[model samples]
Target chain A: MTTLIAPVIPRSRLQRLRWTFADGGVIARGNLIHLVRNPSAILNLLLYPAVMVLLFGYVFGSAMNVAGGGDYREFLMPGMFAQTMTLGVMTTMIIVTNDAARGVTDRFRSMPISRSGVVLGRACADMVNSVLELAVLLGCGLAVGWSWHRGAGNALTALGLLLLLRFALIWVGIYLGLMLTPESASAAWMPLMPLTMLANTFVSPELMPGWMGAISEWNPLSATVAACRELFGNPGWGGDSWAAAHALPLAVAWPVALTLVFLPLSARRYRRLDR
Target chain B: MERMNSLAVVAEGVRKHYGGAPALDGFDLAVPEGTVCGLLGPNGAGKTTAVRVLTTLLRADAGRAVVAGFDVAARPAEVRYRIGLAGQNAAVDEILTGRENLEMWGRLYHLDAATARRRAGELLDRFGLAADAEKRVKHYSGGMRRRLDLAAAFVLAPSVLFLDEPTTGLDPRNRDEVWQAVRELAASGSTVLMTTQYLFEADQLAHQIAVIDAGRVIADGSPDELKSMVGGDQIDLVVRDAAGLAEAARVLAAAAGRDPVADPGARRLTAPVHDRIGALTEVVRELGERGIAVEDVALRRPTLDEVFLSLTGERTARAEEGGHGEEDRAA
Candidate 1:
């Protein structure tokens, strides 16, 4: 009532950009605080990697072959790392979808804040969450006797590649979240099941049927898993396929390509949403 | 003559479509500054769409809307700056505490951290949520969440506020709480446009009511003006059994002049009466003479529900239209 007039928005290009960052920072801080307040969500995140580690490292470790005869637990570590990244993407999608369905997105859209800031905030918040997930999975891997035989530099590169894949998946999640309802988005996320399985994350695709193996190799996820395996000095079949031939570059290329495709798409979908 | 700024919200021929079905078709309204306007309508009536368009959240396919002196589509950012919105759903973050939600909104509105914190505390106290400010919103009851949502909208005390079905799913006590907050907002000279299915809510809060049906404003006037248009008092009766519904309707039709509408679902009959006392007395005597079993009968003043029914029920502009909600117009 007292100050009914709208505050003057900074209109210059640089000021606008500053506002975008400021708004995104505020939203990101809110999301992080939300995470801190809910200890159970963090618990859920921990439980997922813990479950997968037990299933792969112990349950079927002896039966599975790790090509060059290395620790099965080490081989599964990167796979679990890749899988955790994909699950983190689902969490972002679910968060966006819930915000959309529950009207939080509309509330933000109606605000004077920068249009891109909403998504950028979610991405920032979720990237931090993904990092926490990777950390937990790494702890789980260590507990299961999985060690990165490669030097610290290579291990960090592997971690970077895993985060890059997650970053790409985050854009994909934002796009789908903006496009679909919470229920449909939950049911529609593919990477968690077929995509992860098809990728060399769990089983080296070379051992599967020819066509399935090809899909597994080409599954963008496979590149990251293979790249991680090589960097971590984990056992992996470096086959003659082009994807296997250039695992490191493919890990970089796939995420960049995926980001190029989905980043603009998510932004466009956001701008034209409810039109 | 009034200045342009005096008219807080204005819309001209707004239209929107979803697939083949037009959700909002040719809607128009003008609400003056500092007044409460209720966009009253039933389900699927495009009230939500109208609110979205005016709030700059959804674009209108045709026509222009001016909110607080800025064209909604052309100057959406400016409009957004001036308006507060509590969407149909309570959109608060479930994981954040009530206090955190307000502070977040404050910071987003460009308030400094210290100002944001102080303002958030003030709001929590004003909305009576100070006691539970530290509790996570996920654990808060439905009423608490809605109250927080409304408080978030007030972080800036915006000139224009849009509330789409603000109290739709709330219980009576919570509804009262929201209504009280809305009244305070309106009294503080903030223009408010709220949509609701509750006739009583519109009657209680809105100084001006726009009766919307089938995506169009069918009628617009003060509640009293609208009630007067329904002519006079109404006679309502509930039959003891469904079998007596037809007989009760026939007797009331002759006495009240207008044919009574029988809503068989509720075993109730209603007819507009010109001579209130005469019609009530005659109806009671006639039903008794005919041995009609009447469970209850009463004469009541015409409400906004009747006004709405009279406006929308008779036109049926869309043609496949039904009566106003559940009160079936089976004459």
Candidate 2:
């Protein structure tokens, strides 16, 4: 066999980053194509948003009252968007677990591509699904007369915040996915329900018990939900805590912090899977 | 760029542990360029573990490995460019079509767009997967998927190919297909290191055979070198009746000049023989004379399990060598 060795390996740091994205983009495309072929996986991504919109907006919103007198549906929309973003964890975890279990992760690791690219590819691809899920959730929100009372620019920024939150959770999912088995990862969604609920996605943390409310206010999901509500100009619960007072900054901080912790951990685990 | 080297793969005292006993305890191996080396071992013998280390999927706790002229641990990214691996289980994506799996790997291999597409097409045809190229791997048969797995690793005919138990579960026809494909890869001058349970597969494909037990290479040589060391053909006798097993075992043991390994469940006695025809005739005549009926008899090569028993009990050859060395020193 003629040697395959040569200029393939990246020499410079910038070149390395370029190759990582290029390779990651290839991997991301493959994952997205799988979604197209397997409708069930796509449906799983859609299932959470659809169910949450109905369960919260029509059912629970009918009886609920916002703290400062606004339509409950408007308050519920931002929370639903934030909740859907975090729901990505379940899908990402399951996919990563499957690949890890099936030896797909090992195959990727053995290749000459960038090591972090495999993890990054999965995150990027899941982001595409998140974008689509957000669109559908937005459609449902608009159909139910949940209009954004803010400028279009502010509304788009709110959507960007939700996506940023989703992007960071994607790393968490990748890390956990590498840590768990496929069967257990499938059951992972149950535990995540509490994570989404621990925040202000369903109800204001202000209404919860003392310690629980503090936790909810600090919850990353709560940061995104609170931030989205403010940007969309929906009903904000307006708590006195630092996390409550600065939702936008906390939303950015929480996801960025989680990404910082989990991205390297995921890469390390993938490099030596059995260990 | 440096040209190809003579030894394509080399591992020195590579060790790994998963908590309890280390899987690979000071394992070592060396495969010259462009030769097929078969690694044979029983279950949990660290065959797969060793493959993982050399393939750059796992880093050893100690020691070092060089594959395709780069240290596996220190420069795994560089080493990765020159090797292909088909793990124990088929590692291809099940949801993607067979063609997609290869094309995706091709892209990861740093092939340009047009080249990746063409390479996928060529591999699919070569591996007998062209007809089912469009089908998702989940729908492909075990054999087809395995061929595709081989095809995936063979892209660019990687300088050193590592296949861990490539034919563990396959019918004869499928096994033949894989063997032929491996032969083609070797002919193209690719260094292939394959771990297998079947002695027959090793005989047919491997230029050098390495029998590993408990994570170390206990024996390494050409097929003939191994054959002569492990010894002549084995005479296997299946007694007609379970009651006559003792008598048949006694006969074969006497003829072969060693105790035959008797299987009560199968009513069989297997013993290694120096002279194949003489041992076969003597066992038959003696059994007839003793009125012990014979169900079947055959001359065959040693099974990997039998080889391990003899090799381990050569668990065996090492202690004797140590004794001889001491005696020589004393003299």
Query: What tens-digit string does per-residue lDDT give for candidate 1 at B1-331?
Result: 2226689999999999988999889999999999999998777889999999999878999988899899988888778888999998998988788998998998888887888898899889878899999988988877788888988998888889999888878877887888888897898888999998766578789999898888899889997776667676678899999998988998899998878978899899988887777888898999899898888787766554565557766633233232232221221
Candidate 1 error regions (>4 Å) = A1-8, A189-191, B1-5, B239-268, B273-294, B298-309, B313-331
Clashing pairs in 1: none
Best by DockQ: 1
lDDT of 2 by residue, A118-144 (tens): 777887898898899999899888888
How well is each residue in A1-275 modelled by candidate 1, as lDDT tens digits? 13333475786999888878888898889888877767787778789789879988899887898766677888889988987787777788888898999998899888888877777788899889888989998999999898888899999999999999999999989988887789987886654677677778877777889999888888888889899999998898857899898989999999999899999999999889759
Which candidate number maximizes lDDT?
Answer: 1
- Write one digit per residue (lDDT tens) for candidate 2, span B1-331: 3233699999899999999899999999989999999998777889999999999888799998999998988787788888998887788888899999999988888788888888898888877889999999999888887899999888867889999899878877787888888898898889999998767678889999998888899999998788778875688788879999887877887889999988899887878888877778887788878888777788777766556667777432222211111110100
Per-residue error for A130 in candidate 2, Å, reads 0.6
> Which sections of candidate 2 miss by over 4 Å?
A1-17, A59-65, A267-275, B1-5, B250-259, B264-266, B274-300, B314-331
Question: What DockQ was computed for model 2?
Answer: 0.52
